[model samples]
Target: MDEKKAAILGEIPRLRRYARSLLRDRDSADDLVQDCLERALVRLDNWQTGESPRRWLFTIMHHLFIDQMRKVNRRGEAAMLPLEASEAQAAPAEQVESIASREIIDALQAMSPDRRAALVMVAIEGFSYAEAATILGVPAGTLMSRIARGRDELRGLLDDAARRRAIRIVEK
Candidate 1:
């Protein structure tokens, strides 16, 4: 593969992780990543030659994710079962960690896509605020606001989840 193609290929793991975090469904996330790679390769020339393609590829993915969300909204698609109903049996030793991870992901899923993307890019992906803003096509200030609001939203959601869990334990 050419250098540019190689660079794009190298980012697949990051893209997949980001996509999974955004969509919260492995199959859908894989499709989104595939769509993103297809678009990126087809428009490869549009990428600036010397600059790193990291931000460029992520921008493409963010745009595509938005488009998918819009299409889903218009269709009023059916909802899938949440993680709890579909969760597999894990080893007892891993249950607590698994539940905690699922709670965090579920909270992320509950956020609006814009705020979730903002949080994921900056906090999870370690993008700078400015870089995430540029990738998300928002102003820096807007990105910061989204991150703040997202953090608060996550806290509230997680707290609610914890309370529910505690109540269940106490009721037992």
Candidate 2:
């Protein structure tokens, strides 16, 4: 039990980071991480030794994140904050170009939850296609389609967002 607890403790940061990226809100991410850890701890007796704890934790986080996304979607309200404000308190960037590129985060928030999760798994979390497919519980071909469509949707959404921003600036 102690060994299992130690193992879970070690993976908390990575799990939290993935959740934060998916949820896009600091408070909700932390809550999700805590819930995941508690669930894992309770189920630790069933966890097989020699298996990757990180992967197990990630699987739990993935399900929890998906469940939360569903609930949020049912509420018919957006969970994402404005992209610029979200980045303002992040780690300082040494280059102005880095700051300019931060608008992509906002664009990501505008995406559908399925696309956002798929894109984050591949593009942000650096998971391979197979790993992401398994994590997302989709067939490889379906995963590919989701990712391709996700990219196209993100591009369109971001372009629209940027255009709106530009128009607002011009109007001002």
Candidate 3:
């Protein structure tokens, strides 16, 4: 494969991860990633040389996700569903991780889409502020504000969950 094609292909996992974080449903996320890849491939010639392929692909995914959200909102459909446990039994360590993961997912879902997207791009994906801003199509200042607010909101959500869990433990 050419360098450009190889670079695009290498970004699939990151794109999928971002999509999954945004959509929260495995099937929907996969569909979104597939759509993004198809679109990127079809418009490959339009992509400027010397630009970051990962950022370009993420921008595509972000726009698609926003479009999907708008459609769901127009239809008055609920965007998120409760997280469900897998059927397989987990070991103790796995179980702990699963519970913590679910808590974090729930907290993330509680955030506004913009804030959640900023958090995912910066904190989860480890993108630089400028790079994330480019991918999100927002000013660097706006992106920074969103990240700050998202972190605060996420902190509050997690803290509340912890308190609730503590209450349950105490009551039991």
Candidate 4:
């Protein structure tokens, strides 16, 4: 494959990972990745030379996700947070870590898509604030606001979960 194609191919794992985190279903995530790759390939010429394709591709995927969300909203379907189904079956020794992980993911998924996208790009994908802001097509200050609010919301959600878990333990 050519250099452009090679670079785009290399980002599939990251794309799928982001999609999975957003949608919480492997099949949907794979489809999202495929759609992203297809769009990126068709618009390959639009990708500038000597710049990182990661940001460009992520921007495209983010738009697609927003479109999908709009469609779901129009249909009156409720947006669901990713459930910790797999973690629920963890062995005794792994349960603590599993529950913690589950709580974090649930909290993240519970966030508004805008906040979740901002947080994921900066925190999980390791994008700089400027890059993430550009990718999300928002001003730097707006992106920072989203990130700040997202962190606060997550802390509250996780803390509540911890408190509830402690109550359960105390009751038992």
Candidate 5:
């Protein structure tokens, strides 16, 4: 494949990962990724040479996600489905890891979409603050603030969950 096409194709995994985190449903996330790819293909000409394809694709995905959320809000529909146990389950040897992962996912779901996106980009995806800001179409300072607030909120959510779990264990 040509360089441009190859670059775009290489970004599929990252795009899907980000989409899955945003939507928390495999089918919905796949659909979102498909829509993002379709839009990117159509606007490929507008993409500048030497630019980071991953960042550009992320920018497209971010905009599409925002637009989709707006449409759902207008229709008064739930934007995300509840996390399914089957989807969060992992291998026996990694039971603890699986529980921790589930807790983090739950915390992320509780956060505002904007904050979650910023955290996912900077923390999970390892994007620089400036790159994440560009992808989200916000200033660097704004992105930093979002990440800080997101971390604080996520910590609180996890702490609450831990306390509830402790109570359940104690009551047993």
Candidate 6:
């Protein structure tokens, strides 16, 4: 049992990185990792020997991430993100990049959780559609459509933001 747990521990960093990219915040990623570890530990008896431990841990993490996404979608951004003011005050960066990242995050938050998950898995994580579909528990065609929609929506938001910036410059 100790050996099994030790082996599972080795995959935590990759899981954390994947969760961080999916969640886009440090604390949330940590929480996801903790949850994934707990779940994996509790379910260790079910894990078959010689199967990919990394993939198994990732599957658990991905499911937890999906659940977190659904909860946020239900509650909306304002309800989920109470640290925004503090974060904004502390952020030191070129104004344009900050504004763009904010717009992108906002656009991502507006997307359906399923679509957002698909985007993260396919685009950000560089997972193949088949692998993403397996993680998402959806058909590959469905995953592709969700990715397409997510990309289109993100592009629209970015384009609108650019246009607004251009308009402001013109007015000045």
Candidate 5 local Cα displacement, residue 145, angstroms: 1.0
Off by over 4 Å in 6: 1-7, 72-103, 167-172
Query: What lDDT does candidate 1 reach at residue 110?
Result: 75
What is the alpha-carbon lDDT of model 2 when measured against the actual structure?
0.76
Query: Of 2 and 6, which scores higher on TM-score?
Result: 2
- Residue 104, model 2, lDDT: 68
Residues 1-172, candidate 2: write the lDDT tens digits: 7888898899888887788667655677899999899888888877888877877787787888888878776785554444455344463345243423555656676677778878888987788998888878889998888889989987886787678779979999
The digit string of per-residue lDDT tens for model 3 on 1-172 reads 3888899889999998988778655778899999999999889988998888988899998999888878887886644433232222232343344667866877786678899999999998999999999989999999999999999999998898778779979999
Distance (Å) between predicted and true CA of 18, model 4?
Answer: 1.6
User: Candidate 2: which pairs clash?
Assistant: none
What TM-score would candidate 3 get against the native?
Answer: 0.85
TM-score of each: 0.88, 0.78, 0.85, 0.86, 0.86, 0.71
Model 3 stretches with alpha carbons more than 4 Å out: 79-97
On TM-score, the candidate that comes out on top is 1
Residue ranges of candidate 1 with Cα displaced over 4 Å: 78-97
Candidate 1 weakest lDDT stretch, 10 residues: 83-92
Q: Can you give the lDDT of residue 143 in candidate 2? A: 83
Residues 56-98 of candidate 4 have per-residue lDDT tens digits of 8999999999998888778866443224333443434533446
Per-residue accuracy of model 6 over 94-172 as CA lDDT, tens digit each: 4334666765765665566678778977676677898878877888899999999889987886787678779989999
Candidate 1 per-residue lDDT, tens place, 52-155, comes to: 68899899999999998888767865244343432442324533456788788878887888999999999989999889999999999999999999999999
User: All candidates' lDDT scores?
Assistant: 0.85, 0.76, 0.83, 0.82, 0.85, 0.74
Query: Total backbone clashes of model 1?
Result: 0
What's each prediction's clash count?
0, 0, 0, 0, 0, 0
